[model samples]
Target: MKKVIVGNHAVSWGVQLARTEVISAYPITPQTQVVEQLSEMCASGELNARFIKVESEHSAMAACMGASAAGARAFTATSSQGLALMHELLHWAAGARHPIVMADINRSLGPGWNIWTEQTDSLAQRDTGWVQLYCETNQEVLDTTIMSFRLAEQVNLPVMLVLDAFYLSHTAEPVDIPDRELVDAFLPKRQARLKLDTAEPHSFNALVPPASYMEMRHALQEAMREARTAFDEVEEEWEQRFGRRYGAVEAYHTDDADLVLVTSGTVTSTARHVIDQRRAAGERVGLVKIKMFRPFPTETLRAALAGIARVAVLDRNLSPGRGGIFAEELRAALYDVPAEDRPQVYGYVLGLGGRDIRPDTIDTVIERTRAAAAPDREDLWVGLLGDDGAPATTGRAQTSADSLPGVEA
Candidate 1:
């Protein structure tokens, strides 16, 4: 049935349908509703599950790891700081090869304190060896939630799907809540390939000698490589039954285009409008929306941008001294492509801390990319304060009401 619901509820619905046996989470902005709804489901008997009200994000993840290792389907949810707290256990779950699924509502990290959207938190954990899938809409959130479980179990790696703070987490949209029978058929009971069996005691995560550590790490890497194709097959099976399919990377009209705009999360929606408007004006421009970040879709990206002359990567998250993380990865991914075939990729950072990413902001990125003499590795701030963090006297630095829509000085 199709009903209008916020992204958080969509996640809860997906979890319920997947028949998650264990859920452990601590409340944080935007992500609180997801756990709250799940708790209610558990209490009301609509969902048969164990809802663990853990003390902190770390404990929540630890509980999930334990439950998952005990041969149960486990899950959790969190935001910026909450996600940061779980960083330690994030590695544990991946290293143990536990198929735990988590929903991270992307929010800003701060000294000044803000609970708005930013991808920095999850991106910071890039080296943690977890599968990351970023969703662009509420519907995608629900569908991805269900599919993530299948993918995680298939590869024996934890999966984390991200949603923009308020744009996605708090907003409402129509979502097709999959029928119980369909979801059951799609994602049935998980029979652990390995588990904590009391009858057959075995050491898990025990001390490993230096000689054996490298081999274990290599095996995990091999699984990650296999996940790339496993993810494709999972989604293909989903499309066959559900009539909807979103690839690891999604391309919008890149065919024979000279310039392309790259984005993830909600920004992709706005970029699509910009692309449509530009196309009407007879411009050879396109948009590429990345859904799966980890198992980084190298070959998929190469094919989408193979012949393009220039590409603009707009990142809402930053790496401080380094440029946008996504841009850095793209540069490396395209490095081996023949020099003449690789496009000059520009990285633009914008819309941090829940600030809206309007179509005008995206337009500026494309304009700058077209004018730049060479690919800029340094991150360029798209919406900076009017000069010195005060009112701008003129030009693009103007921090006037018109300059910052819905922003109060």
Candidate 2:
């Protein structure tokens, strides 16, 4: 079925089609609609699932954990502080291998309490064992949500499908909703081999001695590695059924390109426009959109970026003193590539706290990359407020949404 729907509703639809048995989530801005729609579906019997309206996000995840342990396929959605609050249980879900698929509408963290999009919330949970997939469009959000359940259950690791707060979540777009029967065939009910079966009363998740702990960690690492390939297969099957697929990492127009821009989330859309503009005028520029963030796709990224002279990594989320999260990971992924064959990856942090990442801002970054020597991996906060709370640099106003270049206050 084709419908024009907001990203949150698309996610709700995906969860419904996946036949998630237990849907639990607490309301938070940008993510509330997802919970609301699910609740409505549950109440109206439109979805034959148990919708647990938890008091908080932490409890929401806890409910999912319990439900999944009881051999039910589980799911949830959250953003920003809600996700932050669920941090501890995020580990529990991944550690216990719950296969709980979550939709994190990326929102800015708050001390002053802003409710806009930012990747920091999800990026901060990198240490947790969840397989993270960032979506670039409403359609992708819907599709990734369904694929995530398959990926998560296959590896028994949680999967976080992320989208920008307003850009994807609030923004409505034409989406092709897959048929429930097709989805049922694609994602059958999760069969948890090690679920909490009452018949086989046995200890699960008990404290392990040091001798058993490291090996346990290794197992998770192994599963994550396996998940990378499993995810590919899942997408391949999805393509066969739906005729649309975005691989774990998508590269655009990289052949014979000297410069390639690396991006994730909705920034990829904006970056695509910039790349096209630059490419038309005889600029050898390309783009690599990272969809999967976990298990890092080190080799995949290395292969895509190989032979390119310069790669500019656009990080929408900062790790504060450490620099941009994606940039750090990319450099690490590309670290083993022989220096002569390696791309000099300049990491630029832009559009924190939901500030619009303008096409010109990306243009400025590209120009800066062209003019610069090898970056020391220092994060350049492009168009961010200076110490005096002013626009850092002014290059050109490329569009009406261009909040870059001479940003006023």
Candidate 3:
């Protein structure tokens, strides 16, 4: 059914249709509405599931861990400090191989206690051993949530579905909610290939000697590598049923473009608009939207970026000393490609703390990147100011190791 719905509600419906057997969460804006809607659905008998009202985000995840360990498909949602609170459990969920899926509304971390959009909160947990997917729209949110479950369960890892807090979470848009019957056909009951079955009487979180610890870590790494294809196949089946296709990355207008822009979450939508407008004016520009963050889609990114003259990476999150988080990842992804196949890359840190990124700003980023294609230059930061009132540009070869705090490179 087609309806105007906010991103959070869209995700809520996705969870509903997925028939999640367990949900545990605490209220934290702008993510609070997601849990609220699910709570109402549970109370009204619209969703037949166990809704555990926990006192805090930490407890919420703890409850989810218990539920998932008990052989139920589990889920949760939070942002910023709430996500921070759930930190220890985040590692537990992934390490336990519980197949728990979560929705993290990307909000800025605060010194002044702010609740606004930023990518730092999610990026901070990059090493937590979870498969992360960043959504560009409400439709993507709905679709990715379903795909996340399939991927997580297949690899026995957790998945984090991330979207911009206010930009996509609160904003309403036209979304096609897939029929419940169709979703049921696609994702049936959560039958575990390797679940904590009390009947089987197995010990999870078992103590391991040093002899097996390294091998266990290696096994987890192998599973993550194998999950890429598993993720692709799940989406293929979903697209065949829903008439929409998604993957680790989605490229737009890149076939014949000289310049490309890469981003995640809601910024991809803004970048797409600018690409379309510029295409109308005869500019050869395109965009690449990264949906999967970890299990880093390295080869896919390299293939998409190959042959482009220049590429601009606009990240709403910072790596503190480094300019843009996504940009740094992109450079790493392209390391193995021949130097000529590599494009001149520009990095921009914008939209942090709910800062606005107008279409003109996107256009300016692309234009500047194309103009600054010096062979020796390695990195440039657009839309950020330097100490001397200049646009921020750093040598691409340097990794911001010596960067000072509050200073743009």
Going through the candidates in order, what is the number of backbone clashes in each?
A: 0, 0, 2
The candidate maximizing lDDT is: 2
Q: Arrange candidates by lDDT, highest first: which order?
A: 2, 1, 3
Tens digit per residue, CA lDDT, model 3, 40-147: 999998999999999999999999888888878999999999999899988888778888999999999988788989999999898888888999889989999888
How would you encode candidate 2's per-residue C-alpha lDDT over 98-145 as one tens digit per residue?
Answer: 899999999999988988888999999998999999999999999999
Shift of residue 7 alpha carbon in model 1, Å? 0.5
- CA lDDT of 372 in candidate 1? 62
**Candidate 1 lDDT, 186-289, residue by residue in tens:** 99999998889998777789999999999989988998999899999999999988888889999998997888999999999999999999999999999999
For candidate 2, which ten residues in a row score worst on lDDT? Answer: 394-403
TM-score of each: 0.95, 0.95, 0.92
Q: List the residue pairs that clash in candidate 2.
A: none
Question: What CA root-mean-square deviation does each model show from the true structure?
Answer: 4.1, 4.1, 3.8
Better of 1 and 2 by lDDT: 2
